[model samples]
Target: MNVEKKRVLKIFYLIATSSEELSSCELAKRIGVTERTIKSDIKQVRDFALDNGAVIKSRRGSGYWIEVFDSDKIQAIVEQLVIHFAYDSSLSDLSSEKRSNDILRKIIAQDGYVKLDDIAYELYLSRSSIKNEIKEARKVLESFNLGFETKPGFGSRIKGSEFDKRLCMLMLFEIYYHKAVLMFNHTQLMNYFECEDDVRNDIRHSFLKVLRESSCHIMDDYTQRIARYLILLRNRYKAKYYISFNPEKKVLLKSFKQYKIACDIIDELKKYGGYDVDENEILALEVFLLIWADIDSTSDLAGDYGEVYFEALTQLEKISERIRQEYSIEFFNCEWDKKIFLTGLIPIILKIKLNCEKNDMKSSVLFNDSVRLSPLSIKLSYSAIELLNEQYNTKNSFASHLIIAYRIYIIISKVKYDYSPIRMIICSMHGIEVARSIKNSIINKYSEKYFAKLDLYELYEMRALKYDDYDAVALNYPYFSYKYDWTFVLIELIPTDNQLQELYNKVILQGYQLKQFLEFFNFNKNFVFRDFNFESMESFINLISFKHGKESKFIHNIEYELNECVIKSIYNKTCILFINHQYVDHNIFEIYQLNEIKNINGEEISHIIVLSVDFNHSIKAFKFIEQLSHQLVIDRETIYLLTESEKLDNIIDIVRKGLNSEMISLV
Candidate 1:
């Protein structure tokens, strides 16, 4: 019931219909197979037709003709085949296995003549599987052949007269050439052929042709369409795949049987769900899916996908009642029209949504799935390829899934095509976070390709770098100032109202002093600073309690180094950054300990007490949390968060709190 296998069989019907009394030679030429193949296929064709009540017979020694038992039988067989194709697709491969066995039996009984590769392919086995079976056929059917026979190279033979032998051999070869033969490799054949439009369109069409072949499930048609659809699907998604069997599942168990269409839209609620994208791009994605679907419509990818396609047609006839009965878009329901296929409307719809506009503004062919990137905005060399990456990596996507991507892009285009300046805000529920990380990785991998822009809002779209909330991007080392501008901004956790105001005041008062220090020492043109929680329980001694000196020595050292730095200003000014690290917490021992300790601004100022001389700052909270070190109340991230902004408000609050009690300045 393998859906793909059934589709391939359908291909045989088309190939078979294209010829007159097609012999093994004719079939091999038309279907691009070999004579050996045709020889084996005839038997399969006979058996399949007979099993379904068709007659494949030879008059004496001329050739073969396939006719159903009668008109009713033919109609019934066609209907049955279609039904089987539509219900469960997993059994088409089994049909080949059965056909192969039937041929093997007939060859042994009538003569050594059977279509082999058909079964081999349909069974998803290798050519060797057929060879091995054929070798054993003579022994298994010896009684039927009366020990009739096969030489090293000669095919199976009946002991009857030469005329009978020729008849059987001819029919056998016919089966091999048409029914059983596996024809052109899809990829290679595509290379040989020139597509009508772009590579993507061509690929879509080739897949459709193969799907049609598979739908018929005729042996010859199957031969003509081998591997084409799989190859194309792989190309579209950039995914590699091959039929695999699970020994545990034993899907091929003769008793196990449920074969239907490859994909049933009704059952696949996800793939075919109604409109999952924005208006601008929905039509485009829809049209694109239709084109893709049409190319491989041999089976039903029509799951959720079919709804999009069906709606596009505006099926005013059948859906007329449904449309009027339900949501009412007007009762102009009909098929999407053959025009889409002829004019490459699907691709047009997609490309147009991507800004590849076409003449028809309202072609229902469009489908906008947010996974697709902006068309109005310039796209990468292979933007579609990036989407394919999602298909391969996560088996899901935004453009193909939720409409968030499209909405984001619309916002971005309004602001500017380049989202480098904007910070992309992501919620846990949104899928952008995943894309954000991946995009950053890609950016780092190809630094030259990007200008090193960090936009949180467009992180997923542009492969931007990641910046944690409130984490300042170090602008230290004035020599490197020219290389970058516009420091990335992240929101800080303003612990409390007191802390927020304290920061504003600290920045305003210490603005010039701090700016001078950075300009002289670290050469940071733009100082990004902030403070987290403010407390009254801490003092300079608290820093000393942090196992050693002030744990926030990192901040102090940065300030101390900046104060000692030489400025390029014409005034030849030297600046000092006095930050008092005392707060409400009474862990004074860990508060004010660093280099060149002394009293400044009425409090002890810590020097290069931190690990880095450039990241020095006052961490009064660090001193407070030091008391709970064993319990590890404050983690590294907390430390980072507390020092998110370079503003001294938190430090000021700490100083004010320390003043309320007994405070000591280490500097």
Candidate 2:
């Protein structure tokens, strides 16, 4: 089995070993993935289980649990499969992340300095390759306050405070626990602490007993984390690696309830291991105890008391006020909702305060889909969060922002739809020469009488255009009028008196509908054009960079992503709509109108739209592009309008209102 397969197996193993069914949300959180991905992963796991003579039982409201018959045989098969694949030299072929993790685990599990050559040999890689892996792994370790030290003879080793060292171990364990447990086994894990099996077992018992005796509650996840820390702390204590708490930490320690708890744990250690724990070690334990308490309080935010709770509430109040001012949506409408939400923010605030590391897993696929599916919620939540950050000096993670977005999404879904202004897009093959006047004349005629906004676009014979953004797509020529599910109208650039009245009746008076106000004529009786000219694509990319990537810190990231799309289009020689959302936080899209200039060889090329938005707001944009690309093969008039039209602002405006349609009940 590959590592991914092994991971799925481990998830199944956890579910099988659990006493109760696990929710998809909780499972995704534990596995550091989005719930949407988890659902698909679960289905794959279910299929695998069926072939393996096992069952994954799921209930409608509850969740999934595993069922296995003949546990011994299943265990034997799993263990054998895991060991075989995990130890194979093919492990070197794993992704850079997996390879780096392998090297890090090897470095930390060793008793002394780990030679690069030894790692290369173990993982089947070159010495220089292992060095690069170590370099990458160092980045991850640094987040936990751990660093690497290199000597002349011995290669390199991790050097950090004993506390940080244990924390790094736990963090790594979460990502590669199954692989490490299977490959290194329990004995090596004990060897990392320079202890025998009996000593390790005694330390575990004493640590838990102390926690139980002191009535200090530890969550199951944190219990595993603390247990590992205790083992390392014992070895470090024996080796005389004690913590030297500064005056500031000591001052903070004085008021901590966990201090007494730490003292009790130290007494238990002395009883079991027959070692007199020093004052410095006791203080170190207290620090760990305090951290444990922080973790515990965060587990159930509503139940937490004291400074953390009050501080979060204050921040929430400022955030709420800023949101109301910017979006005109009242967030603090009910005291009950406010309290529940404020409690939720506690964990997010704690994470920022601690500078906790997040999993490298990208935002779940569901997150992207949800943002598109709930435009109103996304718009309000994204705008509000931006304002909150500026006003309250709070830096929330993307995931935290997503939580707020989801909450507002639910609330907004429950309310009645607000009246929205109708947006219409007009396209003409005569280009901007006629599009502007037609749009202005129509808007002037109808603006006072109806709630509608009209914009004009030029029609392209070779380019696909997305008409979904507009309530109606008005076309000038018959062949130019593409068939789409959206409301479309065939009218002349200069409408006749009867045609103008018919347009007013159909669009302004009749709300929204498909209407051919004027008769369609085949005006292109004799026309043949093979030449297609376009302005330099780079100019538009630069324009977008100037518009969206002015922030110096993000310029490189933005350019790097843009270059990938540019390269992709150039190599394929295809008209592309590039939407890069890797680093942005708001919606931004740009169109590069292709000009019909000729080269020395008189060859012509096409143009593209470099529409970039935040990752959350990209689903609808991507769908639009996908459909547009298909339409390009069947109809080219849309691209003509896009390149030749002067209504760039109108096109952008319609796209800005892309996902903001009112919710319609199927019933």
Model number with the top TM-score: 2
Measured against the true structure, the TM-scores of the candidates, in listed sequence, are 0.17, 0.45
Question: Among all windows of ten consecutive residues in candidate 2, which has the lowest summed lDDT?
Answer: 514-523
Q: lDDT for each of the candidates?
A: 0.30, 0.54
lDDT of 2: 0.54
Off by over 4 Å in 2: 1-92, 109-112, 178-190, 193-219, 258-314, 317-338, 341-667
User: What would the per-residue lDDT of candidate 1 be over residues 92-139, giving only the tens digit for each residue?
Assistant: 333333334334434422323334454455444467765755554443
RMSD of each: 30.7, 18.1
lDDT of 2 by residue, 1-667 (tens): 3656655765665565568999888677765678887787787788777766678998988989877775765665555454433433432135566677667877775567878887787666787777777777987776666788888798888887765666666555545343434333453443544556687678878888778776456545556556666667776666665666567656645554667778787787776573587666676666545433423322444344356667777877777765554333455666555655654455455444443323221233323544433333444444545554564465444555555665665444333322245667777777876767777666665452344566666655314555555566666768535756556666687766666665654444334211211011111212112243324445545555655664766666555545543432331122443433434444443334344532312233354444343322222322333333333322345445444553332233232222223322222
**Model 2 lDDT at residue 667:** 27
Say what the RMSD of model 1 is: 30.7
Clashes of 1: 135
